[model samples]
Target: MCGIVGYVGKRDALPIVVEALRRMEYRGYDSAGVAIVDDSGHLMVDKRAGRLENLDAALAAHPAGSFAGTTGMGHTRWATHGRPTDRNAHPHVSADGKAAVVHNGIIENFAPLRAEVEAAGIEFSSDTDTETAVHLLALEYDGGEHAGDFIGSAYAVLRRLEGAFTLVFTHADHPGTIVAARRSTPLVVGVGDGEMFVGSDVAAFIEHTRDAVELGQDQVVVITADDYTITDFDGVSQQGKPFHIDWDLAAAEKGGHDFFMLKEIAEQPQALADTLLGHFENGRVVLDEQRLSDGDLREIDKVFVVACGTAYHAGMLAKYAIEHWTRVPVEVELASEFRYRDPVLDRSTLVVAISQSGETADTLEAVRHAKEQKALVLAICNTNGAQIPREADAVLYTHAGPEIGVASTKCFLAQIAATYLVGLALAQARGTKYPDEVAREYADLERMPDAVAEVLKTGPAVRDLAQSLADVNTVLFVGRHVGYPVALEGALKLKELAYIHAEGFAAGELKHGPIALLEDDLTVIVIMPSPSGRAVLHSKMVSNIREIQARGARTIVIAESGDDAVRPLADHLIEIPQCSTLLQPLVSTVPLQIFAAALAQSRGYDVDKPRNLAKSVTVE
Candidate 1:
């Protein structure tokens, strides 16, 4: 995963590109660099192997007049090919120093390309798959059928490259132009009067223009100061899909919160509302892109939910809801392991792929695998114009805007809402739920925003609880049904943000192994089922809490406001508004998010950018 920004505008490119990199730094923070064609028409690159601030300090140490250009590109790298060092930073230059390139994904054929270029007496200065691209471009431009053509040489090199990647190239001689292309990885163009922009995503140029063009797979783009052109690798012209970004720059900002994670956690109510809006129309549940007919959905005999990390936890909930509502056999698999298992799939199988950023490598591959087996794929994503949605037979957008925090918050809730919508849609299509019943379920879902908002009121109490357990070396979470996934997600958040050992178990499995970890003062977080809706689960959870408490463990139970049995059992009771069993995670998850962020703050850890993690996983 990496962030890339390329601009050819009338204004100074340095500040614009640098600010864009700052906004996209959530994508990657291993290293930072910028390539600008100075006023003298010479390529100038400055990079450092650390955070963007390290590159900022390097730039500040130099005189302001040292670098100036109207055409430039910038990169913030999450190193994959080599170690995070200066030599492995992006904006890698050619041996001839005429071409500079910055790239986002892995190059599957870089080894052979590197060997071929080396045989031609080109010694690489850095150990990066991206370095081979610049060398190949220089070689192609210096002498070939397309000699003296910048775009032609760039396309020639791109045609030979392999794997998922977004690449931007600049030549010192062509200061007014930049060449960019993408295959599998994301790339977009920003339209502005008297200017043009290209980047890995809209956030790179959102400050200047919301009119964005999303490039399709294997497409190349050439951006000049005043216009842009899109084409295939063979030089055939193509049109990009244009769309407007609804939210402004303020949405991406912290909004006075100490960290983006805290602000995102607080935005869950609105995010859930936005995701559920317009999904229920004409007394029917609708998806955003429904290329498949209702007949196709009704014919589906098996369902698979594939995802990774937080999205995978959301998939676990999807499996529970889909099977319960539609009576279809549903299986949830880790995307990385889905294809390898040779899962039995066919035209009757429905593969639901969930990803916040549609470009997640493993999920994308899983989608491809399912498609290869003739399974219809539906993507539930937060991002528009991303690869997974583009490739899916249908899509249900989460509408979570942008999640800048490396550890997801609002997006996870939005995804859960999307999954429920999918379940309802399938149930309706299969005639499992009556039309009036579907409408009633949707009306209940529409009430969840208020429930989530009510849950936010418990933040101060959750913060206090988190502080009390901040010094504890271990924390365990337990729940049944949908609450079990919330427990897993809560444990994941603590482990991600607090850097401590945590685990989540099904309430019934505590005695199997996890109960052995309990000791005096050990903290165990419990997600209580709504007693009115699932009295059996609620009673079982109470018994589980009592058992943990008897073993000298301190319990923090998230339960409904009127659940008196669990209220007395919990050492610290975090009450949430009562909701249906299927929708409880929307509220139960909020406190755990607050707890994790607050706990990490108490431990003096960065709550937004967890170490060794990127916002999007573009590399497998």
Candidate 2:
């Protein structure tokens, strides 16, 4: 994944685009660059390896150029095709300096295209697939019927390309215009008075304009200072669906926090509340967008959930709830491995896809495959107008606002809340639960925001415990029933932020194999179920705690508010608010997040931007 921004506006393009890139830096930060069409019809370009600050320093040192040009584009890369280097940075320009291009996503046929261009006796500059696009554009503009036609040349180049990409082009001859197109990647056009903008997401130009036009697949857009036009690749006129961003610019900024991760963690309460708001009307649960009718939901025989990373963990939780409520068989599959398995499907099957960005490469492809097999597809997503939701038969928006943290916190919780609503809706549609039972479930959900807030009160204690164990070589987490996914999520957070060796196992499976890894003073965190409900699970967990403690392992137990049975057994106890058996994840997951952040910060790591990771996975 990479961040891209383009501007054809009255304001200075360089600063505007650079600031937008800063907002989207969580997307990618391997390298940064910009290309601009100056006022005198000249192309000015600069790039630097490493973070955006490196490019900023280069711009500061060479401040005499035409960075003030009103037509420009910028890119912060994630480095898929080549190493992170100055020459490999984006905004790859033509040799004659007449055309420039920036791109996101992969070009699968780039090798053949590069060979063909090189066969024409044109030398190449860098080891990036994006450079081939610029060279082809320059060649198309140099001669032939498309000669001197900038948009026409861009169209010609786009028609020859295969694979997913979002390309924005600028030509020195076309001073005030920008041509942009998308095949499968994300590209949005922001409509502003006397100006226009294009970026990977609304966060790029949200400060200047909230009105945005979301382009469909295989569409092209031409933007000038005062107007914009949309068309298909074959030159047929088309219109992009427009929507206003509900959150403002301030939501994208970290307000007096050490990092965006910390801010997002603190915002979890509001995130969950907002996701649950307006979901219940007229004593029934509803979805954000429901193209599938009630009869369609009732006819479902099997359910499949496809997702990756934290979203996959949310899907695992959804499996438990959906099956329990609707009595339907649910299967959770990793999106990367879904289609390859050649799963059984039909019109009666319902496929649920979960993704925070909704552009996750594997999950989007899985959704496409499910739709091709004539299965009804429903999507759970955070970002509005994202590709997966746009292609699905129905969608449920998480309403978590902008999650800028690379390691998700608020969005993960919001996904759980939204999935719970989906479960209730399915149960209602299938007549599996009475209307009064569904209302009670919704009421219990409404009280979870406060329960989550209560869990935040224990952050100080969790941080203290985490700091003491920051030097440990390995940590193990164990849970049972619904807590199994929470344990897995905890281990994932630790591995993502702290870069430590961590593993999660079912509490009952300690003796199976994971128990051998336990040694003297090794830390083991156990998520204890509620003693009031499922006494069997709580007792079994206590036995697992004892098994680990007998091996001289240190214990940090997360239990309900008053669990006296574990008082004498736990070396360190962290309490969370009591909730229903299935709803425990909503509260149990908070302390683990706090503990992971504090532990990573204690080790002097940047929790916001972990090494070798980007916020979104746009490439497979």
Candidate 3:
């Protein structure tokens, strides 16, 4: 899950490449590096083994003053093929220093390839599979050929290797060109005036231009100082479809916040508002696209929500609403393991695949498998025109805009909001809930942005609590029903941000195993269900809180403003705005996000760029 950014443009390549790497910091990199072609046909490489700030300090120390040829490439690496050392950092160079390559995704067959290269008398310096690619390109360039021919050779070499990858490289000999290719991973090309850019995604070049071209599977792109050409792996020329990006570069910036996570936490109001826009009118929910007819939706007898990580938590939240509103059973499955188990899905089953980026390999594969089984596939995604959305039978797009942080923030809220709308649509179509009842739910959803805003005002308290517990080694979260998923999300955020041991469990399951972990020193965050809506769940959770509190755990209760039942057991209480039980996740999740971000910041870790994590999981 590394980040790759490249440019073939007229400006000084050093600053642009470095800035792009900084923008990509949220994608989780253990090391950062850049390689720029100089005016004298030399590839200038600079890299460090720490965060991007370390690389930035190095750049400042040795100011590669206006290092000027137009072609360059950069990488922020998450160590997988090698350790997090300077020698293992990306922008791997050829032995002769003629070519420098940056890559994302794993090369599964690199061991055999490396053995063959070593047998051929090539010496390797780093342990990364990416280095093999650079060596192969060097061998290809050893032949006297044009840049395009060498790119074709490189493509052929890549074709022989197994696994997923998106690679970009530039040779010193080809001073004004950068060659790139992708397979089972994402790579986008940004077009600008008199310049060209390539990145693992659009966020890399969103600052320069909003126009981008999505590279197709097994396509190689040859970019020059003034032109770019796309071709298939076999060298036949192909046309690349270009799309316009709607988000401006400002969205990627921190906007004076301490970190991207905190900034995103504050942006939730606008994000929720944007997601809610155009979704409801006259007591009916509307989707971005209606490919599935009412007959198609009504004929569906079962539902499967497939996702991974935070998206899986969203799916869990969706399951509750879908079942409650439509009177249909819904199952949530991790996409990576969904197809392997041979689930008994059929024509009557509807597979709802959720992903922020539609490029999640396992999720996309699961969606494909479901379609093969003749299941109607629906994709809920934030990104437009991504692979899963394009391939699915129907799509519900979450208009939360760009979420850059590796650990999700606004996307979680957007996903829950989208899923709620989808549930309402299903209930409306199936005649399960009354029209006025649906309208009331819609009205509750309309108030969510403000509720989110109110929850965000708890930032100061959360920050204080985070600072107090920054040194704690472990945290436990417990919730019932919808809060259970919120607990899962809470634990995930803490693990991602704080690098601490955390676990989330259903409160009902606490006495079974997890309550034993509760001690006088341990921190327990309980999401108290809304007492106004469901008395049973609310009372059960309160009793659960008292159980843990009696066991000497320091209880931090997140309860609705008017819920006084949990107050007696709460050592610390965080109050959220009053909301419907089903919609509480949209409010409860906000405080946990703030708490995690503040804790990471207090620990001196980068809240936006946590260790060993990336914003997008492009590889399986």
Candidate 4:
């Protein structure tokens, strides 16, 4: 999956598409290009092998955006089936230059399709599966069977593709419209006054209008300046679900922060508050979009939380709370590996799927697999009307609007807050907790936004510590209980942003193996338990810190305020407000994010768009 932009309107397509592609550069940064249809019926595609700026330079010498038409498509490819070279950059053009295509998602059967097309005397120019689709569309448009019907030709081309893809194309013969199709990856239509837009996400078009229609699976859309028509691959008409984006264009901007990461970090408190808003009714936790009834929740005996990457860490944190509150056996599984394991499932099983972009390929496939076995699927997502939420039995949306940073900041905390809501709702349904107890926990959760805000205020110290450790070759994170997942997430952020070798270990498992790597010059971050309560855990963690410090590892402790035991052993001590055992993750995780971002910046890396990573993993 990558960035996709298509516009058919009265505005100049070049400047509009270039600006939109810049907005979506976080989606893919390997290469950027655009294909525009000029007034003289020329299909012009100018792309380069570097960042969007490279394409900007390429367009400078030969401006395709200055063409005399307002219909075009742009793409920023994150190399899937080819290398990041000039030849492999999109928009992949047909040999005749009659058609061009920009694509997201993997075309799994492109090899066989390439073979078929080659046998028919169609030569390929680029080493991309995207090229094969463009050639196939040209053939369909020029063939004896479906000649001269761009929309029908697009429908035919889509029916032959084997894997998930969102395709938007331009035809020189039909400069007034663009044909787009989707199978699994994201594609949405932006409806405006006298024009329409298509994008991989709503952010691409939010600046123009908030009126968006989310395209469903296996649907094709034909759009012009005035109107759009949605149809199935088989030519059956369908209507897409329309929704308004709650956030304005400013949410996707950096807002004068040094980086989008920093801005998103500062937005976490408000994000947490929004996620927990209006989730209570009549002293019991309420869910607005629940299709699974209280009777269904009461009958659930097992829960499986499935996700990938940072979301997988959120799922790990959710497992602890779900099992503790509902007394149901909970299992955390990597979404990419969940379906392959042949796990048993039944009506009594509840699968909780977490994804910041609900379009994550592995998690979406996992949800489908679970539903096939008669399991109830619940989605915790940020994007409204995303496929995972629309397909699941129920959904709880984390209203963290438009996290543009490649590394998750606000969404991670919001997800944790949502998980807390999920646990409370389950407990209320199962009679696992008294109503007063549930109310108290709910109130505590509501107040966590302030605690998170307090932690955000303490970010400068972590940034300072990170600047000191910029030259450190390796780092390690250790924790107990909920902090364990927080450690893993912290380590992951370090590796993703700082490009360092980092690992997270359970603090109690030190002697087994992780401690052997504790030598001089290596930094270890220990997330300590709250000392006010859980005294036993606090004592054990303090012992773990001392052991690591004794081993010559410089230890950084994330401890609670007024906790004095860790002060003597810690090389750097960061304090957070004391909260309940499970909720410590909300505050304890903040500094790690700040530190990772600062360290990456000190190393001269782009914290907003890390190398070789996309904002959304839309391909499996």
Candidate 5:
């Protein structure tokens, strides 16, 4: 994954480009660089191999803002083509130094292209496939077809590259212009009165303008200080569709938190509320994916949920809710492993695919595989107009706006909310629940926002406890039912941020294998089962807590406020509001998020951008 920003504006381009890179750094942080065509016709590029701060320091050391110009491009690379080193960073230049290019996405045919270019006596300075594109662009620019036409030369180069990419190129001679091309990967263009901006997402230019255009596939855009033009790969002009970004700059900022992850965790109450809005109609829950008629729904016999990482956990939770409410057997599988297993599927089956970005490679591939089996596919995604939604039979937008943190927070909550809607819709279709019963469930969901807000009030206490537990080398979590996924997610958060050994297990399986890991002073966090409707699970979880405590382990129990039984046994008790057992995760998950961020911060690590992770996984 990588983030790109290209701008042609009257304002100071250096600061604008740098800030855009910072905003989209969640996309990639392996390395960063910027290329600007200076007023004197010198194309300059300055780069660093580490975090964006290193590049900022490098720019600050220079007096001229490290490459000031009116037209420029920027990149944050995740290191697909080469090792993340100074020489292999983005904004690579050609041998003659006339052309510079910043590229996102992998080039499948870079090997042969590199060999042919080298055979022609063109020397490459870096190991990245991106450099090969710039070299080929220089060769194409010097050709007789369009020797001095920057956009034409760029279009010619795009015609040859055979992979997903969003490329930004600039020639020294074209000091007042920049050319950008989009293929399979996303590229957004922002429109201003006397300026233009192009980026991988709207966050790149949200600080300057909210009006933007979503560039189509296989299109080329040429931008100048006062105008912009668009064309197809074969040179036919096309109209670019524009839309306004609903969220403003405040949504993207940290709002005084040390990391964006912390602020996003605190914003979950509102995010889930937004996703829950406008779903009630005719005294029942409704969804945007109304393509399925009730007759079609009754014809369905099974359900399959496919996802990856955190989305996979959400899918697991969905399986429990869907089966209990719709009386249909549901199975959840990892998207990466779904198609490989040759799962039994048919038109009678419904496949629910969940993703925040809607561009996850494995999920998208899984959708195609489901269609190959003629199964009805439904997508639960946050992004509008993403590839997955367009390919699916129907779509349910999560409406979680923009989540800038590398680790998912608000999107996960919104996804679970969307899954609840899907469950209610199916229940209504199958006559499993009466309309009034569905309305009551919808009312319970309507109350979840306030529940999440009440949980947020415990952030300071959870954070301090997590900071105290930072010295522990390993953390373990256990749960009985829906709490099991919350346990797994809690462990995942600790492992992701604290970089420590962590694991989650079903409370019943403690004696099977995982219980052997418990020892003196080892921390075991328990997501206590709610005592409302599941008294058996509550009693069983209390027994599990006693067993772990007997092993000389420190127990941190996240229990409901009135659970006096677990309080006596819990070494450190964390109270969450009482809610339906199935929906307790929406609140139990908040403490885990805050604890992970605090523990990682106490260890002096960057909680927002973890090592070897990107916000979106564009490649399989």
Candidate 6:
């Protein structure tokens, strides 16, 4: 996961590139750099192998007016081909320093290509695969006279390389032009007046303009100061499709909050309500204008939900609900591993692909594979009109607007809510539940926004508990039933935010193997099931808490209000509004989010942009 930004415009490229890198800090990086074509046609490059602040410090040490250019490219790199060092950082330059390139995605055949370049007497400077690309371009240049000749040579060089990548290059000879190309990786062009921008994603230029262009497969774009041209590998000119981004620059900002996570945590009430709105109309759940008949749903034999990381956890929770409501066998698979194992599928099988950003590469590929196998693919996506949604047979959009933080909070809740709605719709269509029964479940779904609001009110206490545990080296989460996935999400948040060694295990599995890790210094966060319909689950989890507390483990209990049985064992008790067992994940995940955010903040870490992590996984 790397971030790339390029600008060819009238404004000074330094400040714009630097600010865009800051916005992309959440995408995780070990180094930052920028290369600019100055007004006098000199290629000026500055790079450092640390956080953005380290780059800023280096820029401050140089003279104020040292570098100037109207066009440039910048990159924040997550090391793949080399270590995190200045020489290995992005914006790799040619031996003659005439061409500068910033690249994302891995190059599978860089070794053989490097051998060929060395055989031709070309010298290399860095260990990055990107350096091979620049040197290859330099060899192809051959001191070309026409711009088209140089462009054609660059395209020829790219044709020899293998593996996924998005490349943006600037030549000193063409002072104001930037050449960009992508294959299997994301690249977007931002349109502006008398200016053009290229980046790995749309967030890079949201402050400048909302207008953007999506680059399709094997397309190349040459952007100049006043215009841009798109072409294919065979030198045929092509056209670009324009897309309008709805979120403004303000949504990417923290709005004076301590961190992006905290601001996002506070935005949950509105986010949940926004996701729930318009789903219930005329006593039925409607999904993105696609209506399914009872026969269509009843004919389904099996269901599979595929996702990665937090989205996978959401699918785990969905499996419980969908199986209960529809009386169908459901399996949840990690999207990255789904296609490799040759999964069993048929016409009657339904595949649900869950992703907050529908651009996740592996999940998108899995969706495509499922469709090829003749399975009906339904996408539970928060992003509208993304690749996954376009490929799926149907889509249920989660209206949790723009989650900028790397660690997911509101989107997880929204995914659960959306998956629950899908389950209810399936049950209603199959006549498994009466209209009144579906109406009753819809009432529960409607109350979720307020229930989520009530759970958020417990953040203060959770924050206090987090501060007390900030010094603890290890934390463990244990739960049963639906609380099991909640525990996994809790541990994931802790690891993502606090950078601590944490593990989540089912409470029943603790004694089987994980109990040995629990000791005096270890803090255990247990999600206690509500003492309502799932009395067995509630009693079992309370007993598990007691078992761990007897072992000298500090217990942090997240339980429903008025649950007196669990109070005695709780070292820190965080209350949640009572809801059905299937919907408990919506409320149970709140305290975990607050705990992780506050703990990370207390340790002087950036909770929103956590170390070595990006907001989306666009590369496989």
Give each model's whole-structure lDDT.
0.92, 0.92, 0.87, 0.90, 0.88, 0.86
By TM-score, how accurate is candidate 6? Answer: 0.93
What ranges in model 5 sit over 4 Å off? 61-66, 144-146
Query: What value of lDDT does candidate 5 attain over all alpha carbons?
Result: 0.88
TM-score of each model, paired residue for residue:
0.99, 0.99, 0.93, 0.98, 0.95, 0.93
Separate clash counts for every candidate: 0, 0, 0, 0, 0, 1
State the lDDT of candidate 4 residue by residue for 480-525, as single tens digits: 9998999999999999999999999999999899889989868999
> Model 3, residue 130: what's the lDDT?
88
Give the per-residue Cα lDDT of candidate 5 at 522. Answer: 91
Off by over 4 Å in 6: 61-64, 143-148, 235-239, 289-299
Cα RMSD (angstroms) for every candidate in the order listed: 1.1, 1.1, 2.5, 1.2, 2.0, 2.5
Candidate 2 matches the true fold with a TM-score of 0.99
TM-score of 4: 0.98
User: 1 or 3, which is superior by TM-score?
Assistant: 1
Range of the 10 consecutive residues with the lowest summed lDDT in candidate 3: 143-152
Clash pairs, model 4 backbone: none
Return the clash pairs for model 5, or none.
none
Compose the digit string of candidate 6's lDDT tens values, residues 479-543. 89999999999999999989999899999998898988878857999999989868898888878
Task: Give the CA lDDT, 0 to 100, for residue 430 in model 3.
Answer: 82
Off by over 4 Å in 2: 63-65
Per-residue lDDT of candidate 5, residues 1-620 (tens digit)? 68899888877788899999988987757999988887778888889999899998988887755477888888998888889998999899988888999988888899999998999898888888999989888887887387877778888888889987788898998887888887767788888878889998888898888888777778888888777788898889987778998889888889998888988888888889889999998686778866878777788899999999899989989988999999999999999999999999999999999989887878988998999999999999998767777678888888777888888989999999899899989999899999988998888888999999999999889989998987989999898889999888888888888899989899999999888888899999999988886899999998898889899999999999998888899899899999998788899998988888899999999898888988888777
